[model samples]
Target chain A: MKRLKYILMTLCFSAAGLLQAQESMKSLMDERRENREANYAKWGPTSEHDGMGFIVRAGYVIGGTSPLPLPAEIRKINEFSPKGGFSLGIDGYKYFNMRWGLSAGLRFFMQGMHTGANVKNYGMSIVMGEDIVSGNFTGTDITETRMSGFTIPVMATYRVGARWTFNLGPYFSYWIYRDFDGHVFDGYLREGSPVGQKITISADNPAFYDFSDDMRSCSWGMEFCADFRVREHLNVFGLLDWGLSDVFKDDFQTVTFPMYPIYATLGVAYYY
Target chain B: MRKIFFGLSLAAILGLVSCIQDEPLNAECDIEQAVVVTDDAEAWLLNASEAVQDVPSADTTIVFYLREEFMDENYEGWDRLKDVAINFRLTPGATITPENGSAHDFTQGGVYYHVTSEDGAWQRNYHVMFIPVQPLTVTYDFENFRWESLERYCEWFEYSDQGNEINMWATANPGFAISKSSATPEEFPTIPWENESISGHSVKLETRDTGLFGVMMNMRIAAGNLFIGTFDVANALQDAMAATRFGLPFNKKPLRFEGYYKFKPGEKFQNRTGVIQEGWVDDPDLYAVLYENTDENGQSFTLQGDNVLTHPNIVALARVTDRVHDFDNWTHFDIPFEYYKEIDEERLKTYGYNLSVVFTSSIEGGAFCGAVGSTLLVDEVKVTCEDEDE
Candidate 1:
């Protein structure tokens, strides 16, 4: 848990450095670009609306999960280690003008989170198949999950001050695989309600569960991306795919949190 | 491109609110442990570990074995126990009757324990029975054996004290064996079959290590043992009343306790907390105690580890301290009853006196300290009633 905290902290501080570098790099290229401005009358297909092309990109994704309804104090989230996933996509775009455009694309990505927590005093009612995990907890708990799928996203794109670019879109996904599993250790479980007798969860008295097939197979969500061109045909990008649907099937409620996958990624792309 | 990506991200956020699923439930079904802490040494021992407690329930049954001679009608407890100060160690998400350890009036029926599964779909209803104290029988040959499907072994049950009829004996083997053992009589540790017995199979007790997990819970050692009353595991960690207890209601002043036994002591000498003694030797224990079954206020009391050997209420005692410690052959040994207080003849009819013939592989096993390889085998045990014809 402490390691995860430190990693996230590092990410927060490094973000600003990357942004500053990108801006400085953009400015350094601006003066040179002005000296070599393309002819407006005959810029060929490289200028604005005159262009129609495809771009392929691959990226590294970081996902975030929030276990809601369970107040922070109750679910004293102790450890969080988000496995970095990957995304690859191809998109075709047409510019209406130099600054505005529309794009549609197919993207494949894997997103999820691994976390350790403790349910101290807050009570939650969870259902895992024919079982119920309902009650407050003070024991160590861990949950690891993942969803791999493809998304069809329709994005609006904009070019800002030369080659700096941004895109945002809504997408629909059809997932091929998912896994949800966890363990509760050295704790007592009140089988039924708050007033239930306790079952010990320790080395001698242990418990583990799986909720893989019970997850949702299809969902809808949104994606956003920002890119800076390093060359005429190559661009480095950062993207965030925010899931709007719960990973679990409609009837499944084993996890008390309304968990949505917020995947963030950075990659390089080739425009052709 | 930036404008297009930003616009799509806003649109995805719109559906985020509607995608929330239902919540999960807590799945646990167990009665962790229970204890009694009333500060009445003459009546109730404060330590649950000294008594028979923490009895693991069958998936469907919650068993709370009581060890006293008579229950206080208002058994929420006396003095300390009534203040609702005692707590139950349950699963993280579990709740119990007498909500929050409040004073519960168990004078009528049972305490109910409901366990909800993790997925909110299923739950179990456990009927927790705190069997009140009653008189037990004498003269045990250790013959009755029945196979209960749950344990997949020959198991014996505690006889009811209410009806004054009993054909069974009790033991600390339940706590000693440690695991969810499903072995028959000829198995390891507790139920080892006795081949050299003069009669049917005798009881063979061997000391054991309950394992690392048991040690983590402070239950490191399990001494081979058999006794006359309850050994409730739920209250095993509290006071002697909750864990180690050894007397049942009896009327007459017994003359002697005679039994055939074989012995072998394990090499190591240690205490319940796992502290090893450098030069101490382990020895098996056997004794018969006749003590007052009622306190000064006429309240019921059962002899427990705290006061069994030294209590002022004791009327007679028969103990074996100089037995042949390493004998393998079945040997006959007898201890004559020594009287402390005069037997009150009228009190005998009122069931105010009790007798306990207890045996264990290690004398200090109750404190979680004992030798690991020690074994005690016994058969043909008989308690001489005070009848003149005998």
Candidate 2:
């Protein structure tokens, strides 16, 4: 037992030394990649072309959102967004030994958000003194809305090391579908009262009416994704997509104001 | 290769250590902060008297201006009016009552011309029947009665001590009386017999000696009489003067009455249609006879006090009777301005800017005789302008 223990201790020490040696190798590789990246940055695209190799990239697409304040009396009903969607893209390694590659692919990302708000139709009667007008009247309809849009990232990639890769470029997408269901002064005023007048409001026109219009259209922006390989041909990465163009053409006319769908995802990628 | 591998391993360890030091030192940026402070204190008064200015009095009369320029194109009948009296035991309440009078206009709404009350709690009310001399302006002399005194007469003495009662209630006084008469004294609700005559005439007070005389008269009307007139200035003035009673000029004239003579000098003494008798006679403890002038141009005009023999104007006082004017179809011919030349222009102007000279039946002596009632129609009766005099 004592001899076995000694053998085990020796094995452990050897393993520790091996790990230290491997760490040193990783640092050397990282330093080499950094030097190459600096050189590339100074001269733009580098000329280090190698044999053709395929890069399978997978990563988290992250997006930041700023909550917009609604109009004076407009109410937000509900928002539909994608909790998370998996993205997969393929890149063709061309030129010198997989050093530079051009990538092209389509990604179907869906974001469904659930949010809602309410608005108050303002009015007054002689019964209530003129001075004491209601700020938030009870007899007003609360507008409910649900928005959804799609994103597809397309770009080119340049690799500095076996694991480190940087991607830069633009993306295109279409808000294939959206639904908004509305009710006029729902549950607000009684049938016969003036306050009970049914009114349906929309984002398409300045006039409030008793109808609805479709809003799904094509909108696009830019994107940047970086991958850090955990091992050969495998990487965990981060991606950011910013909307270059507005989702709503007429943000002011749209009764619900402008809301651009943004997102962030965490995932893995495989490179060949 | 061995040396190279060893060098790489050492560099990797150092790099990891440097990477660990790159974390942010500050982490409190995400916490929320709040602050609160008090607002400034200030006072404000809205729509109060300080915010409004009184309408300045002008020598030029708006009533006369409107009368001439603005005529009611819808006038359908004769210019007729009745002064419906709204009496108050505490304060003499007067305003055009609803009587034959249209709801649209009343002296343009006629008001109770004069209010009389005796020492006793007994009060009497009377309404004047006449035509406007030109939608003559009707304004109450608010200063005439004490504010505290008039307040008691408002409705039933409620709201008597109001702070802004003077100006607030001035708009609804003798010229315009507001009623809160849900409760009223039983006996005082009706017009007194002395003031029952519809004509606008003289009030007779009798006296042996100046002492408390237990006499009273009062008038009350629910609604009905109204005044009608063209918007024409002349017509409005004529309609407004319909309910007015003119006091005789204080002149010493020795007169004799032999047989039945016309009370009026010429033409009809009282309007055949709109005639009213007003005034009364008091006789000490004996019989208090109340006479009204019903006959046009043919009634008596004299009032004798209980002390007629001892009175200064003994003869005139002895032969007093009720008189009414035959005012129908009469022009300004027989009764000229000279008829009442003894009346002081200044005194008449005080009641209003307009003054009308009318024939008066009287004895040579001045005496408090019986009352008289009569109706007279006056038109375009206003202050004589220098241009008109010329």
Q: Highest TM-score: which candidate?
A: 1
**Model 2, position A99: C-alpha lDDT score:** 54
The candidate that achieves the highest lDDT relative to the unseen native structure: 1
Per-residue lDDT for A79-187 in model 2, tens only? 3223334555655544433455555546555443333334433231111111111112222342333334455566677676545667767777765554433333322
| lDDT tens per residue, model 1, A151-183 | 888999877645677899898888887888776
Candidate 2 Cα misplacement greater than 4 A, ranges? A1-84, A91-102, A117-152, A156-162, A180-213, A249-252, B1-390
How good is the docking of model 1, by CAPRI class? incorrect
Estimate the TM-score of every prediction.
Answer: 0.49, 0.27
- Scanning candidate 2 chain A in windows of ten residues, the lowest lDDT window is A125-134
Model 2, range B60-120, lDDT digits (tens) per residue?
1111111211134344322322212221122222222232222322345333322222222
Q: Fraction of native contacts in model 2?
A: 0.00
Say which candidate scores most in DockQ.
1
